[model samples]
Target: MPAHLPHGSRASAACLSPVPWVWPVPGCLSQGAISFQFARPAPPWPAMPPQAQPADAGRRVMLMSLTGLVLGCAVPLSGKRQSQSAWLRPPGAVPEEQFLARCVGCGACLSVCPTGALQPILSSSRLDALFSPQLVPRLGPCAPDCTACGGACFSGAIARFAVEHKPRLRIGVAVIDQARCLPWAEGQRCVVCVDACPPQCGAIQLRPIAPGQFRPVIEPSRCPGCGIREYRCPLPGQAAIRVVP
Candidate 1:
């Protein structure tokens, strides 16, 4: 340098200069210098033409939409199948498919049940059936004269019908387990189920099986599946009679 430069003048000049510079390596002062080239700002990179979308972009979008639609439809169908065999619906309830479609999962039916037999299905494998009303015989029996549930249902899931029609409505069928029934299993004189049968529905009848002994027999045609027999059964742990859908 012919004259001493101001402090940082070299760095400042390096920033302004267009020429390449030679800088000394800090620890290799006697060895050599490192050369750095100042590359001309690459002719301001040509504005890349906006890339065209893939030819199948629209197709891909449409396929995704269709897949979503199919999944949406499949979920309800799968739910219906899973819930088909789950619970016994209340009296006057429509067919399973129609009932599921019409039911809003409102607790109207459960609230109006006099016997507390109509309980809300709190949990189910299928989300669609949740909160819907189901007749739980163990909790209580469906009263034969009650039409409250059907009247309470604003949705047509439970059809509105007269109280007299309750006896004719086959919500489900009652089946007696011979092995568990007191008369059949233990040879005891038990007419409790027969006596508990709805007055209007003489569905359970006493049949003389042996000397001075009788067993309860269910006549499916006359049985409205009111579940009174099961509810009133004297046996402990799982009623000898059960109503099935």
Candidate 2:
């Protein structure tokens, strides 16, 4: 037998219900919309070992390779600035001080170079030459007839000139190394250098040394230093005839 509970009391409501009474703890009421939670259990944490860490060796290797690739490309692009003393500016280039001040490094000349002779100087040690345009004779010579680079320069650093007027432009003077020249050193009859000089320039003059042999001479006054002779020199490796700044 059970005793009767008081009216309007919690014990009275429990006693009236068909289900058995349970303590009002967290998540204890499953059928109601209201969730009256006083306490909650912590979630299980994921396992981690003390020895587990990032792979230092793999990360280091990747970093080194990326650095090497960047420097390797930069060597050709800007590392050659050490030789800038011998670097010749494009034809119609303004005076050195004025050119440096006006050049915007737009690389317009690099785009229109038909012979790919014009190259932009990137990453120079000197701020004046950085990203400026220069001529690379080993690749090819500035064609006597081509005035594309001059026209591309809108900054006035490189003054635009007519193609017919290029003959009067003097970029540099070619210097001959007698020690490496085939005609002067080996006494070989090589007229390649003289023959390659621009027509009507009279930049390269040949003097007869022996029968069927002649030594090439550069007339500083007449030579425009176009570097065509250096590019066509018969010598291997470095050209016997090179343009000087």
Candidate 3:
């Protein structure tokens, strides 16, 4: 027997001597080259260190702090006393302060609006105004003849009246913005609002301002202030003819 070679040692393939310790290394040698290679399997990956686990304490603290801040802010806002909003009330509605006390969030007026002009007041400075009915003229004009909203209100907030007897339903008055009105500012012949007014009510009329020029004048006494003119105004942003509470 040939002398034993130490581990990882190699003997030439050409060597005829009996070599009992030859390690094969693919392509390490030519057909007659002599070489040896020994490779131990990479040590198993080191066990995950304790530091590898996530430190979620900071995240939990941040979430808790954010939640606390929201609640803290909300508590003060909700606790503060608030008064009724200065928005226009539905037709036949009582005075503002009294209306707030009498009105319930029943959406009765909203359901009976013939023109769908009545909408629930969803947000206001006062929490009590959340569900109050207000006319959204932009959605639809308040019909002069429709008394459905007043008739449906049983809470006495909105007083009911007969159709023949015109209800003094002055929710708000229309104000003209001379700078935006076509005839007043641009010298254009725009009679949209004047034509839209109810003939019987004669809420608006063209008054001669100069020899040839005329400006529309609103008569508060006869004007129902129904906001039909606001819906009919041609200008953008705030209407040239706007209904104000």
Q: Assess each prediction's global lDDT (C-alpha) against the native.
A: 0.77, 0.75, 0.75
Which TM-score value belongs to model 2? Answer: 0.65
- In model 1, pairs of residues that clash are none
The CA lDDT at 114 in model 1 is 87
The C-alpha stretches of model 2 lying farther than 4 A from their native spots are 1-86
Off-target runs (Cα >4 Å) in candidate 3 are 1-85
Model 1: per-residue Cα lDDT over 4-37, one tens digit each = 2335534333333322232222333233323233
Residue lDDT tens for model 2, 164-195: 88878888888999999988898877889878
> Global lDDT for candidate 1?
0.77
What is candidate 3's local distance difference test score? 0.75
Q: What are the candidates' C-alpha RMSDs? A: 9.2, 10.1, 9.3
After TM-score superposition, what is the CA distance of residue 238 in candidate 3 from its true location, in Å? Answer: 2.7
Q: Give each model a TM-score.
A: 0.68, 0.65, 0.64
